[model samples]
Target chain A: MRERFITLTSPVVPLERDNVDTDQIIPARFLKATSREGFGDKLFHDWRYDSAGCPRPDFVLNDPTHRGTILAAGKNFGCGSSREHAAWAIRGAGFRAVLSPRFADIFRENALNNGLLPVQLPAPFLERVFTVTRERPEAAVTVDLERQEVRFEGETAPFDIPPYRKRCLLQGFDDIDYLLSIRDKIILFEKQHAL
Target chain B: MNTLFDKIWDAHVVEALPGDTHVLYIDRQYIHEVTSPQAFEGLRRRGVPLFRPGQVTAIPDHNIPTLCQHLPVADPLSRAQLDTLERNCVAHDISLFRIGTPHHGIVHVAGPESGLTLPGMTIVCGDSHTSTHGALGCVAFGIGTSEVEMALATQCILQPKPRPARVRVEGRLPAGTCAKDLILHVISRIGTAGGTGYFVEFAGTAIRALSLEARMTVCNMSIEMGARGGMIAPDDATFDYLRDRPFAPRGAAWERAIERWRALPSDDDARFDAEFTFDAGEIAPMITYGTNPATGIPVTATIPPAADPQALAYMGLHAGEPLVGKRVDHVFVGSCTNGRLEDLRAFASLVKGKRRAPGVTAWIVPGSQEVERRAIAEGVRDTLEAAGFVLRQPGCSACLAMNEDKVPPGKYCVATSNRNFEGRQGPGARTFLAGPLVAAAAAVTGEIRDPRELM
Candidate 1:
């Protein structure tokens, strides 16, 4: 499926919790959906909403004052389960980028494939974003997948994404596009091996 | 000198790309209800035909209720996910182990027992515990859904190499210690992030002596410590287990396969990026008192003061408190981690003459139809039933909060499954991971008692 260039320009919300697992991101109870869409409503389901389905005001995601398209969490964000629903929910909830010190391996790939950019920022930069966004709730941050750099508060820092992943995010090209492009090679290999 | 990992990995590399990336040729792909729907939908939308449909296996484990297998799934969402898998498997002409089938079970359990996972092969599943196949000396790792799409379309995946960590364990374990305890001890010594960016090779005599189910239990939790996966070089024990499986090679072909498998072990001169050693003698019947699996300790040990505050608060435990006698409302003995025949037998042996504690709810699920059948054949189910513990149908039940078997919020459950992450079993649910024997002990005693105490 064709995705759009993921350029984020918005304030970021802090999920300050450490080792935020995929089950915590989107509870397993809500993972029964066949389609990936409509997961935004259930994003952070247990934390963002209560037993009665009432939004928890204390939760950062539901706090009307801390609105943004990016979620900033601590280390090992999206760590536990490999369910891609966590990524779908993150993207579905209008977040284009998740700024973290480091991302759990699989979640990073899942987020990138679904058009949600997982930006690895230095500890200081992460702190700066938290400070800037808190002092100025209207603070705007930018993530440029093409340049592999993130801009915030008049400063920019470089991050690394595989060249192919960068190209996909920039061109709205899914990894499948590359696989499709290399179809002849795959066919040749399979035929050669009689696989 | 090549490690077992490198040998299998080198052969699977179909193409090398710039920036240290390669396209890995996948030999087997397993899918389940939760993470696979999106990938199948993507394949449908992109009009990508699966390159090797015959090598793929699809099942519904995460969403199926452990009870009432003959009836349609009652929950609409569960029904929808299962229906989607059934529909996609039919539409794509892929093999499926739908509920009630002899082959039906957890994806990780069903594949290997059916001889679908073999040595010297590369396997990927949408579920994290796919590492369980590594016990057979296969290079099996979990992939995200999009990567699943890549494997489906081309029977390959774009990948970067992972560093190998040789985790060597020496000494014979005390009788009560199971594979679950051995792995918990490993995770505790190395925090949850210890194996990040690495594939762990669990080696040494202690790992070698374990039965296939036990080795699988150890490998199945590789993801809990953030490993790409874990493997044990397949040996005579692995060969003996695979001999009579339906999909396994027959007669002379079996000998040929054994010859190939024999050559797959690491060379003596092989090196790893990092090395860790644990003495099996020190490993006790373990349980997680905190939220993550890495925060576990022997059941006899006191809860650490440094346990995660959030975990402590959610679990309603005080620092330095004894975990024993902390009333457990639920005792779950199932999941890819400990839902096999051996796990059921362990539970049965523990609870044979005693009835389940009135306050504790015991949920016992077999890992596969074969395991379920064997449990009945061995009268393990009858033993469990006599002890007032029902042997439910096979599925990944209560391992995560996906299915109907969720522990009610604020309830305490001692589970034999992998993760004990906060809210893993349900919202506000406190999970303590233990071996099946430990879980059985807790069920009969209605507390976090050591399995050795009962033995």
Candidate 2:
């Protein structure tokens, strides 16, 4: 029932590795809760935390300078298990969007349904953004869902979102909500198929 | 110009939206303990009842123990997830097979064997191994928990159509080589992410000649290559495997079923978006040496110089290190990938009349209660027990290490499961993915020797 997506202005965190998988994003041991709460503390649990459960200073996520509301990870991010928890962890960690050249299909769908914007930018533009964010850590970036544009420091790059998905984001509607919009068609199909 | 993937996808489309997306109807859905809890909660939160409860089959596999069926799950967290699934099933009026049920097993194994998955059906599950059902000529794929909730609210998912890629494996597989080796070999060539943005169809003589059980093994690891799913065109072999199964069509319905299934293959002149050909004769007993499944090498081969150094360090192997003669502390022969009855027989046959090498703990767990029962009746249990290998109760034991069957930290485990990702068996545990024959050889020799060595 939770549904809403809008413009966001925040910092960015760039994970500069390809093929980062779901297990590395959120380790299996932390996957016990039925509730999708407090996963922020456990994102990258094994990498971000020490054996004593203290934050590891070496991990980029624990480094205060790399703070951001957006996870600018590498291509094929969320590559392994089809766990929705990875997307939930991103949301719980207070990230509103993810930017990558490519994303694993299941993870992309999960993020979209859970109100996390997945923006696919070309490698050159992504590298430029990475440089800009690293140089000016506090530089506020804007992602306008309505205009389908991502802007930072007077520089702008346009992105694409499925028209139906854009409409869903703008109207705060989930797939079930959209399906309900066309319930009659579904009913007709089921009846015709004689299910 | 339609591939088998397209034929199934076209039939399942309820509506087409802009940007090549479709409102697709799902005929059957399977659920397991690890991913279904939150989806069930979401359903309750939305006050949404299951549209057609019978379309879904829920089972708890990932968190259950293989040794004890009558005892309560020891880990409180695992017990709670299992309990949540059971409660959700009863409240939603969906069919369920709990821990002690004869029908309860790994969803991937149970679906095809129970005839719940058949040709021309669109099947889905929260677990990625749902691709295993695609072996039956279905549009089978994995869905996330959010998608699971969506399907529960309305038996449909919004999906973007994928282009089709055909992988052709020619030449007959040599004796001692299995479907696992062929798939591993293909993954090694294509890398882990090569199949992205496509629904792959495995073709050519080598694939068609595989038995249904072997075909399932090949399809189960389709997710490891990052494909949405992989499918094989249905033939007489597919129908023969399904005939007279417990959930299959019967009598007059059976005759109609075969007639419909016979038409599920791709047209003769159809075109695919992409195609890659491989020689099956080049494949051998395969094993992975790195964290990802793509880092596989043949049994007689050595690690490559350019292999991931981080993975090599974690695995305690150097470049050019031969896979054979490396000591293995444990051997596991169960998971959705290789836990079927044929896999069990392959393992048992290799170890019969031989002693399990000292200090090598071998766990031979079946994928289902029926598999365990059948194995016992077929003397697989007797043979394995004679070799000092225990036939554990049926569940996904030691695969993901959610239960007591974990391989100890820093130890080497020769596994028949799909993924060999770092710590997949347990924290700091190293896994080597192989076919059951390789796993059986490791069990008897306490090392990574080829199965033919014992023969």
Candidate 3:
């Protein structure tokens, strides 16, 4: 399973809010589905629509201008409730990376394990991306997992990514994958302990 | 240094594998309906019966409705999941406490209360709030579904031992401040995620002064700080709480267990990877402004400026905005965190005569049927109902927005739950995390307020 990691190809959409919790990312009503599909359609189900099921045109994602494979959000994204489904919906929705100032620890772990890149960019950098995404509808953003840098069209600075998480994402490695990489060591230790 | 983490880590390590992880045997495995479904499926696929069925205990809490015991589950998926758990437990010969059973409650609440949690045990559940059991001086943490399967198969997990932190709270907690407030204050001071990759040992006078129920509340939020777990040394209070618990030993066995528990405290000179101290009196009733638990201040104070560049940019809140008197559309007072009988008594004490603010929807859900029964017997439920609040059946209602209970979008809710992260109550619903009393006060005023004045 240790193979070349696939780079994210979907366009990024920016949701500029801090403390975006699991419930908001995917409401409880959506959890009724056992399969992890159909979640993409319900991402931000209540926020993007009104009570009558009409789109809330005022929301950023509801606006046509901000469409992309990456979502550049405000700091502390995925802040409340440790539901892995939040990460599932984000990944299932075809988003490659979620850029924020920080993330709730559980959400970060969930995102990484589920093959979603939750990038921790500085506040100014995140703000710049948000502005650029809002300003240029066609602008493309690139996140190089190998280099651990995020680059956007006409952007002057490259944001930093934690080296360890970057390595995992770049290799498409989850905790189990990382552990399995050293299977021989585990066998050896098990043998020694058994004796 | 021989910190609690090192001692526990050393004791539990079956062997150190080459991948910077240690193979540690889990002493106790707690299962709930939500996460156990996939794990049971994995077991079926692997053709593995539970390796040590006796070590596992399953409970149906999150998805089961509280009040309707004999009625079918309202949600099809929740019912299927609960049914799957019941079937799986029976197939594997593992113990289960189905809803309406005396042992049933939120798994975290039920585990320690039933004496399934004890000092020196390594406990893991598929739910994040599993850290609540750390209050029993154990190494408890949450695991994913896949990891849960691995534990059921081998009764062992590959884990990287965490560094240890000793958080000491000294001085008397002023009247009306509680263990919930103390933990929230600790999160605020240290910042959420400060204890990441660390096991926390909560000590000092303030922690000792708290009851076992209160200590569970503090440890329950340890996960919010990204810690593996939190613990307090076992004392008389711990023994007393465990004395006649269903699963606890009785007669001479109880005395023997107490003898062992008494020696579970860390040595006076024991060192920690990190240490922090706080004056309990300095903490007041706290409420979260931003999406994270750490973004908190006294209810009387204004929301602090999102001065932390990251916090400000994310929260969209200007500094010095008063959190007090901010209008709230809903008030939710339940969760594994603070949905106990004691919490209800506190909330009822504040809302006894006053009516729930007009136009505000308040949900009062007990953590368990036992809690519900206790509250009803104590007249707490009557007081709440008389005040126009609806007492909902048990389960983790509106805490994670998993069940039918949820706040409408853009509405503000004062919640006694552990988290105030953005949209915790519902989509775009702002949640102000507070204690039960503060939630009661908010229910009355229809805004964030201190319960002291209301009483």
- Predictions' DockQ, in order: 0.65, 0.63, 0.20
Measured with C-alpha atoms, the lDDT of residue A15 in candidate 2 is 83
TM-score of chain B of each: 0.99, 0.99, 0.95
Q: Rate the local accuracy (lDDT) of all candidates.
A: 0.87, 0.86, 0.76
Clash pairs, candidate 3, are A10-A69, A11-A68, A11-A69, A12-A68, A12-A69, A12-A70, A18-B314, B66-B394, B291-B421, B305-B319
Error of 2 at B421 (Å): 1.7
Over 4 Å off in model 2, which ranges? A1-3, A131-136, A139-141, A151-157
DockQ-wise, the better of 1 and 3 is 1
lDDT of 2 by residue, B316-368 (tens): 99998899999999999999999999999999889999999999988888999
TM-score of each: 0.97, 0.96, 0.83
Report the lDDT tens digits of candidate 3 across residue range B1-455: 35555665576676675544576767899998776776677567656667679889998777666456688887778877778888989999999987877777788877887888877678888777888887877788887565677678777776656778889999999888777889989999887668766789999999998888889899999877767678888788877777787787789877776776676678778878889999998999888777678877888987665545544444445678877778888888888899888888888889888988988888888887678777888888889889887777777878877666878877888888887755566656678888988998989988877878877
Model 1 lDDT tens row, A48-89: 888898998999987777888889988878888888989989
Quality class of the docking in candidate 2, CAPRI style: medium
Models ranked on DockQ:
1, 2, 3
Better of 2 and 3 by DockQ: 2
**What overall lDDT, based on C-alpha atoms, would model 1 receive against the true structure?**
0.87
lDDT of 3 at B128: 79
DockQ of 3: 0.20
